[model samples]
Target: MKYLVMVQGSQADYDALGGKASAHSPAWSEKELRAMSSFMEELNNDLAESGEMVDGNGLAAPAATRLVGLGEDGRPVITDGPYGETKELLAGYWVLDCESLERVTEIAERVLRAPAPEGSPVYPVVIRPIPDAGGGDV
Candidate 1:
């Protein structure tokens, strides 16, 4: 079975990583950022070696996000993110092919252990199962 594991953050988190401080989070120092990044790389590499990692990627900052919807007249209307700095957003995700939900839960536990700056707030990693071609849940 396949699972989608998500990492959540806020615009303030991204800003901090880029050396910008906000009311929500402090600016991340170079050393802190390096450690965080290295941890992620190592985790991905381990998952890849285990053949459970199917796909994964980090998303761009909230500033670059766009929202598209249909206008009252049925035309597409696009707008910038306009997201609050403290609003939770998707920071990244990993797709893992695992033997059981327990395995995915274990992976999520490991993801939660990723390095972060001291006193940084932690968010729970979200996980959802991917259904097979049939409409039934796998």
Candidate 2:
């Protein structure tokens, strides 16, 4: 089965990684960022070697996000992200094809082990199964 494992974050988290502090998170140091990157890279490498990784990437800052949807009149509307009421946004994701739910669950837990700055805000790692092309949930 294929699973999408997503990491959540807030604008504060992005700002901190960019070396700016916010009320919700502290600035991250170069060393801290390097540690986090190394951890993620190692995990990706392991998944690739095991032939379980389909795709994965760390997303750009929330400031680069755009919200696109249809208006009440059925016209398209677009807006910048970190929308006023949304405290969290998707920070990254991994698509993994694994043999069992337990294996995927283990991978999600490893994502939680990624390093971060001392005062960084911790968000969730969400897991959702992808539906097969024939249309039912996988």
lDDT of 1 at 119: 69
TM of each candidate vs. truth: 0.93, 0.93
Local distance difference test, per candidate? 0.89, 0.89
Structure candidate 2, residue pairs in collision: none
Q: Which 10 residues in a row give candidate 1 its minimum summed lDDT?
A: 81-90
- Candidate 2 local lDDT, 1-138, one digit each (tens): 888999998888888988999889989999999999899999999999999999999898888899999999999999997686988988899999998889999999998888886767777689899877888664
Judged by whole-model lDDT over C-alpha atoms, candidate 1 comes out at 0.89
Residue 113 displacement (Å), model 1? 1.0
TM-score of 1: 0.93
- Identify the runs in model 2 with alpha carbons over 4 angstroms from their true place: 135-138
lDDT of 1 by residue, 1-138 (tens): 999999998878888899988777888899898988898999999999999999999999888899899999999999898466547888899999999999999999998888877767799999999998877585
- Per-candidate Cα RMSD to the true structure, in Å, reads 1.7, 1.4
